[model samples]
Target: MDNFLIITCVHHFQKDGKFYGYGPFIREMNLWIKNRKKVTVLAPLIYSGIPGKIDLEYEHPHLNFKSVPAYHIQSWIARFKALFQVPYILLMIFWEMSKASHIHIRTPGNMGLLAMFVQILFPFKFKTIKYAGNWDPKSEQPHTYKIQRRLANSPFFTRNAKVLVYGNWADNSSNVVPFFTASYSETEIEPVRKSSLKEKIKLVFVGSIYSGKNPEVGIYLSKILKDKGIDFEFIYCGDGVMRPQMEELSIQLDLSENVKFLGNVTSAEIKSILKESHFLIFISKTEGWPKAVAEAMFWGCIPFTSPVSCVPEMVGNGERGVLLSTNPEEIYLALLPYIDDEELFQKTSKQAMDWSRKFTLEKFQKEIVNLECE
Candidate 1:
């Protein structure tokens, strides 16, 4: 019986004697711990009256949860509070590390940073570090993020650990392994036949409607299409604090009829929408793997996304989908070639489906099992 310890920054909620967390994160964790006899999680805990629509419960028989305060250094007050809290958090992590057979650290987060250091004390213990962030050496990131990356890739510090990164990076130790995330499974693969682009083209966005995700760019693209006398429908799938502002912007742009906000829908609904949509417009400022892009591709929804992190590799450098620019005019010009070209659109869609199908949930789970054996 293996005892697995996972330390992450993902917030877990407690309600009615049950634990819930963000859907995608929880789903991936479920796969990691499915075969283990006992699972222990060290993360921030929140007592909420009700879980969000996109939250899911952990599926395990034997579970141990250690709650830690979530902290940030965005403000002076926060920094001061974190300074006092770090010692307690580190102690908890070290205590947990001593008891576990295997340690898993999810990185590019405050909690992950502490865990990375704590794991070094047990140099011979089996460990895995999932660096769920941009692994591109050339990309600019926060100082702490860079520190975490360096520590994870350093053999002397991260001994007996496999550092799982999103993209294939050069000049890394043998422990640094390139990995991918998946949404659908082999059994879920179905023949997706999308209708040809017509006067009414369907464009969808699946993610938080916030500044970081740049949801406004989708609206601007819709405005451009409308101004060109093209009939279109833009759908926003996820919700955030920016929804109200984006809704107002859509109204101001006279896109009330063309834009629809389906805030926080189920995964099934998003998959269904993706199957019918013509394209996924995601012009985010940054991303790790961008599950939305991969999910969109899985359903043959060609994603017009910014070339961030591993996105260019995922899209095959515009062969599977268009690499987007935040500028609406530039995005329009990039997309103009594919709009009316049915043969090109079909070819790209096929390419996307073919590439994305290679990374199914089945494959992801098998990879996890292989990692555990190693």
Candidate 2:
């Protein structure tokens, strides 16, 4: 039987009022657990008051789980605790890595660093590091994230591994590979229809409204359209730290009536909105690969985004959607023509869906099979 071990700092399942990381990682991890016979999960387990369950059920009888003490350095006590807990975490990972034929790591976390150092001891070890954040070095990142990337890409440190990253960056070691996320099937193709040139355009932005995402960009652009006597409306979904700021910005810009911000919505609700929208405004400061862009494109919302991380590649370098620069006026001017052209809108929507469908669950499963090969 093939033995497999996964190491991550993110909670696999939650017990308290807190949720774990987003659903994409949870769903992807479950794919391996359900398909493999001998699999052991090594991660922190939190005991809390929230409802928590695996996004996908495990059918394999041979699956096992081992919980480790959660390690972090958020506060003074937490830092001291992390210093003491790290050794035990290393021991747990070392033991599991030695026994398992496959080592899978989920990164940009404390456990990821320990796993990286442990993996170095076994130079010929078969492992995969899922770097699930912005891959570009030019973008601002935490010092820990930079260190992890350096270690993961160091030819002298990490060997015989495939480091799955969201976007392709320059000067990468042989280990880095560009990856994508998908939610639909090739067979379930539904052709997206664009509105007539004379019709009012609908623009949608989905995701947390943090300042980093710059949801105000959507609001500001809509205001610009309104000022130009263009017919358009903006809808926003998801809540975050900057919700209050967005409210103030909308009121200050006098876009309270034209722009609507709906918070903490479900996927079905988001899908309903995406189906009717003609374009997606997603101008995040940084990302690994913003799932919302792909999700919006799947439903035929032409994703207009800042060329951050792998967004240029994802949007086909403006073939699928418009790439924003540092200037908001430039972004508004660039998107005006697409809003006025029905044929360009429809063609781009179809191409975006076609490109996005290639990275579906079935394709992801195939890659996993190849990676776990005995």
Best model number under TM-score: 1
Per-candidate TM-scores read: 0.97, 0.86
Worst 10 residues of 2 by lDDT: 49-58
- Model 1 agreement with the true structure over 1-374: per-residue lDDT tens digits: 48899999999998777788999999898899988999999999986546788898899989899999998889999999999889999999999999999999999999999998899899999998999888888998999999999999999998998989888778678888889998888999999989768756889999998899999998898899899998789999999989999999999999999999999988899999999998999998888999999999999999999988899999999899988778988988877777868889899999999999999888999999888687
Q: Please, what's the RMSD in Å of model 1? A: 1.2
Superposed by TM-score, candidate 2 places the C-alpha of residue 22 at a distance from the truth, in angstroms, of 2.3
Per-model RMSD to reference: 1.2, 3.3
Model 1 TM: 0.97
Per-residue alpha-carbon lDDT of candidate 2 for residues 1-374, written as tens digits (9 for 90 to 100): 57878888876555332234345566677676666669887887656523232132334567677789987788999999988888888898999999887789888788898898899988877888889888898889989988899998887899888888887678688888777665555665676666664777888888878878888787778778888888777888888898888888888988887888887776667878888888888888888778889888888888888888888998999888888854668778887677667777788888887788778778877777776463
Error of 1 at 363 (Å): 0.6
Residue 186, candidate 2: Cα error in Å is: 2.7
Model 2 residue pairs with clashes: 15-48, 16-48, 16-49, 16-50, 17-50, 133-288
- How many clashing pairs in candidate 1? 0
Per-candidate clashes, comma-separated: 0, 6
Question: Which whole-number lDDT from 0 to 100 does residue 44 have in model 1?
Answer: 93
Query: What lDDT score belongs to each candidate, Candidate 1 first?
Result: 0.91, 0.78
